[model samples]
Target: MTTSSYLTVKALTKYIKRKFDADPHLREVYVKGELSNVKIHSSGHIYFTLKDDAARITAAMFRTQASKLKFKPEEGMQVYIRGEVNVYESSGIYQLYVQTMEPDGVGGLFVAFNQLKERLQKEGFFNPNFKQPIPKFPNTVGVLTATTGAAIRDICTTINRRYPLAEIVIYPTVVQGENAAPNIVKNIQLANNQQLCDVLIVGRGGGSIEDLWAFNEEIVAQAIFESRIPIISAVGHETDTTIADFVADLRAPTPTAAAELAVPNQHELIQRIISNKSRLQQMTSALVQFERSRLKKLQNAYPLATPERLYRPFIEKIVQLDMQLGRASQMYLMKKYNALQKLDSTIKSHSPKNEIQYNYKQINHMTDLLTRSVLSLLQKKKDQYGANVRTLEALNPLSIMTRGYSVTYKEQQVVKSVTQLSKDEEIDIHFHDGKVQAKIIEIHEGGEK
Candidate 1:
């Protein structure tokens, strides 16, 4: 074969590309498949493999198309794509250049559901701590659903059946379609603002994923999370779950179940009340009986039965105290009398009357003694005087003269010597009886003369 006749790898690839480009079916091809080996580029291009059970095809979506996607594509995600199928020349590969993409069937919704759930879970929006406790017996239940939907009817009927006392405030809202999420959020806010209901049941009846998609929306979930009142999520059948279910304070399998959760069964409540009343009656009767028994025991007690006995000991004690007081008073008086007697005796002992009398007697005796002493002394002195007088009389010159002896005197002095006389001097001669003056005419010397 000629060298030009044999096709090169580039030529073969270009030929395939041209064939694909020429085919109108391949130009705007629609495909449904599961995504695999997904790669999101920094430039916002998505590269992945579209696969079914039997085969797979490489696919790519540019930034423009990828930006339009409402949900992120991931591995094993089923998607419906409208795009051009062409062959690349570089690696000689055939691939789909996706222009538009959407999730296929329930798989897309599941992806969105899982993605939002994971996101909210990470943000703690679904945390149990943020959940408010549903009232055990709500006085009012606010219903958020379509007015004509079976969910509202079920909720209302169920609540009425369970608890007739619970009032129902209905908030007619669109529970599906694009407007559903915003409407639900608005209703939640309105209910909170009005403060009309104690609890809220946000829900709808059974539906497909697309039909129930509003309940899965982030805004609906956020509204439930932000509600001040407790929310019960009753989105669908028992098998169906939504984002509202995770963020709500409580999740019920159905709207009827939500109503049941919101209120207590009246029959059961009545039975409980009856039981409690019986228990209270029995307890009160027992308490009264116990109190009566206690009172009877008290009444039979010695102090209570005979109240006088209670004070008898005190009365006896008072009588005894009175006797003791009397005895103490008598003893005190006697002691005072004794003290007075002693005081009188001491006063008498210290009395100036007796002392003065004794002192007077002493003074009289001393005076008498002094008088006797003075008399004796006087008598002795008188006797001495008499003796002295007698002696004096005996020694008297007159007496001597009377006894034939005389005193000679000169100039009125007694002359003791014979020389006392001078010739022609005046002299006095004295005797015991008289004295005479005379003139001496002669002098006589004594023995010497």
Candidate 2:
């Protein structure tokens, strides 16, 4: 009942702190619970509550201990903790000082992986458009991995065996633990700066997620994304994927696969070359045969093969006209001769020497005039036929093309107007002698009136 028996908050707090420190069970404790009211301070300390259905305990992980954690803590996250129970003297409250903590019955790293994956997915880190094309024939292949491991061995062996021509550049890297992320990023930058390799294979042999964590680091992912050289990520087994895998230009299932992807197989390439050579030869032969067939068809065409057939009608017409002219001339001469005979019979009854002489002179003059007129008519018909032939020659299509004119066609159709064409369209210009290919650069829709 005495005031002396009653303890002040400070005194009670000190007693509790000392008592907790002294007890061996409180000094080293184990706890399993769900996290709540989690707060990460600017000073790098984490404050949270460890709660279950029964009770709750206030807990804290200091900067030094928090730095060693593999994953971030969050609200409602189930975790297992190794810590010491103690009372905070200043606050006069009991709290747990966490030394180490991990997710309960689940991997915290996996949780972290999912969170980062979601975030980066939203930021388009895994966009296929951002990926660069891997070189089919790489002169040099850069390998980023631990110098002494199965990963390096497998990669080097595969590359050397498949494509002996490619030079391998090895970048020794730490693939695990605290310093692995930064080291991976540095080597990636170094490889880019050196510009020695056409492509890069970055990875290690299959292992636990913890062992492959360096590839999952954001810095490593960013480095791979920024690399000027195309990178093939081969971090772990086929089933394992990382942030680096998403960001890299390509991903291979394993180290050996990465090497296989980095350089082409010499045997396969040789076979391809041989196949292509055969194909080219076959194509050339086929093309030659096609052109020959086309030329043969042209040679058999009516106009080119039998040019005389085209002029047969004209020749027949000319012959008929000449025959008509001869018949008309003969008819005129016969009629005049008959009239002369009748006149002679009549003149003989009243015949005189002077009269006969005058009639003979008149007959000579008429015969001479008839011959001149028939010759003039034949010459005029010949001139008319010659003029018609000249007109046909002027209208010949081949004759017109012989001038400086050319015909333009787009996609095998005659290009008559600007509306039928568009920018960047390819056209063929045919001249009398040959054909030329051209591309349309600009288009103006209207034409001259």
Candidate 3:
């Protein structure tokens, strides 16, 4: 048997890769399928599987191409991919190298719009708190639209007619085509930097969605959102709305409406002035009549009609005060006179002669009573002294000695009982006339002698 040489896996993979690369048909292919396992790597490259009911294929998009995509690819989303087919030698797998990808059947512009809207919304660009209010009556209106377009003309005409005082500063901008978004952004920045206008009107005449797409761009939306000058977005017709509208301070249905909003109507103002003048005249006449009636009433009032009426209470108060003063003076004088009389009577009662006579009478009466009380007290004391003398004589121990009684003491203490004396103790016998020293010979008990 003849041995045939076979190719290695690496060699076979490279060979297939080269074949796919060289083929004009496979070099650039457009395929439609549902995305699966979509992943965006840290390097910004995207890898996903594109599969249909029949077959599935792996696809990769490099960072550069993937960056151009306006929307993120989600798994199971239907997509149309334009790429080259190739094989990776390391993995030995065939894959699609994606150059461009978009949602199936949907316009790329709409996708971009939705994506930017969603992203900016998440970042709070469409936050109502950031929205500025358009000036009701702008002194200078800055219009960012094509100079030759109907939008400018309408705005200028409306402003000139409605508010002739307002100065219109036109920042001629391209509002359509490729340069439209950048031009809009530039003019907005310029207008803001220049500080030329109180209010900014950014718009174009009514147009198709394509012509109006510039206002929907992220750059335009960001510029409008960041501008300190209040912006009114009037893109396309009333039915059309753009990202600029959502981000701007205000959105006008049309350019003319934007102009009208920026200024007040001159005719309306004039009519208001006239109506105010009439109201003022009516009010002034009414006020004058009211004041005149008030003056008449004041003149006819009691105080104004009779000048003395104002002073009547003061006059009556003075009369009453005078009468009270007279009465008070009389009462005070009477009280002082009565007090003087009482004092004079008191002085008279305290005269020296009368005081001496009164004291002498008191002394005489007291002396008489003292004389009788002294005699009675002396008699009672005499009787008490006699009674005490008799009591003493009756209680006297010397008297009892004269009656043949005596007291015996041992060691200077009176002995009351025979047992009190010791047999050999010295004692004294006290009698009425003498005290005799003696010795206790015996102590007698009972009747023994």
Candidate 4:
């Protein structure tokens, strides 16, 4: 090969780029392999190797395409990458510039993510109703993450910069692997039980799904759900999402973003409070001014404010009251005078002297008539009384005895009938002249005429 006859490195690279762009098959291709030696760039680009047991290829994804990847490609993660295969003459290396990538054969991280997502969702951890709203102005913020991670540093720095008034309480926790989940869960529960914070930030820096799996654990999700205080989940970069995100009261895309969300900017809040206070003072002053103006208007319109204006009306009312009182008194006196005149006329017509003489004359006539009639009635009553007395005296037994009549009595009773006498019945006989002892004679039946 003659080096002078061949193209230079830049020329060859340009030619290869043109060739790859022109060839549709080479421009859009699909490849499957396991990822290795992955290095993520600050510019968001990713460089790695795609290898199998038999072959390997150097791969690259620019920031745009790398940002679209759902799962992080690591040293041993299987993935399917779609991109153009091209030659880079600078390093004389043949590589794949990936456009899109997905897990190869359903990566373990993806499977775990889906499985945990479904399980937590089934357990109601992702229910919107269970979410607690983050406090707008948190007094204290509890952070559950590694003490050494950049996540806690970034969060603390951002919170201190934005809201210096809020207390930053770090519940240091392991943020990866098996022990990470239990530590995270314990910190969350401890934060809640202690009531140390008004809001909680459970998060860590971005990592592969395996590195971030602690946030996806059922225990961590349950701990977040059971927290009485609101939780903001910030586990990864903007594109990175986790089960903790869905179950959290609020999901911030990054730890810095979560810090920005956790509390208001102190300067802005103080400005707003001052503005409101000024507005309230202004409104109160305006209200007082309005009331004062109204009072002034009322005072100007009131008769008491101008006492001379009331004199004519007051004098007119007094004159009218005097006329009414005069008319009422005249009417009262005239009524009394007429009543007295009528009484005097009645007294003249029925004087006591004439009434007494007339009454006396009527009483004298009635007395004479009553005396004559009473004397006649008394003589009749006296004659009747004497006749009744004489009859009563004649019918008396004593009177009969005095007339030579006698009555016989037995057992102190007069025997007026023969049935009253019984044979051999001893009895005392009582005659008109005296009493004697007697016995009943036999053979007396009914021979009396």
Candidate 1 per-residue lDDT, tens place, 1-449, comes to 88879998888888888888889888898899999999999999999999999999999999988875657897887788899998878888889999988787756567778899999999999888898988887889999999996888888899888899999999999998888889999999999999999999999999898899999888888888889999999998999989999999999999999988889999999999999999999999999999999999998897787899778899999999999999999999999999999989987777678777888999989999898899889999888988888898877656667876777866567689867677788887776678778887777675644
TM-score of each: 0.58, 0.65, 0.67, 0.47
TM-score of 1: 0.58
Each model's C-alpha lDDT?
0.89, 0.91, 0.90, 0.86
lDDT of candidate model 2 versus the reference: 0.91
Candidate achieving higher TM-score, 3 or 4: 3
- Tens digit per residue, CA lDDT, model 3, 1-449: 43447777787888888888889999899999999999999999999999999999999999999987767888888988899998888898989999999798897767778888889999999898998877767789999999897889999999999999999999999999889999999999999999989999999988777788889888998899889999998888899888898898888999999888888898999999999999999999999999999999998898888999789999999999999999999999999999999999998887789778999999999999999999999999999999999999999878888999999988788888887777878889998888999887776799797
* Candidate 4 structure quality by residue, lDDT tens digits, 182-235: 898888888878998999998999988778877877678888888898999999
In model 2, the runs with Cα more than 4 Å from the true position are 1-8, 306-449
Q: Which ten residues in a row have the lowest lDDT in candidate 2?
A: 440-449
Could you tell me the TM-score of candidate 2? 0.65
| lDDT rank order | 2, 3, 1, 4
Cα RMSD to the true fold for all candidates: 31.6, 31.0, 18.7, 23.6
| lDDT winner | 2
TM-score-based ranking: 3, 2, 1, 4
Tell me the lDDT of model 1 at 229. 96
Clashing pairs in 4: none
Give me the displacement of residue 302 in model 4, in angstroms.
Answer: 3.8
Task: Report model 4's TM-score to 2 decimal places.
Answer: 0.47
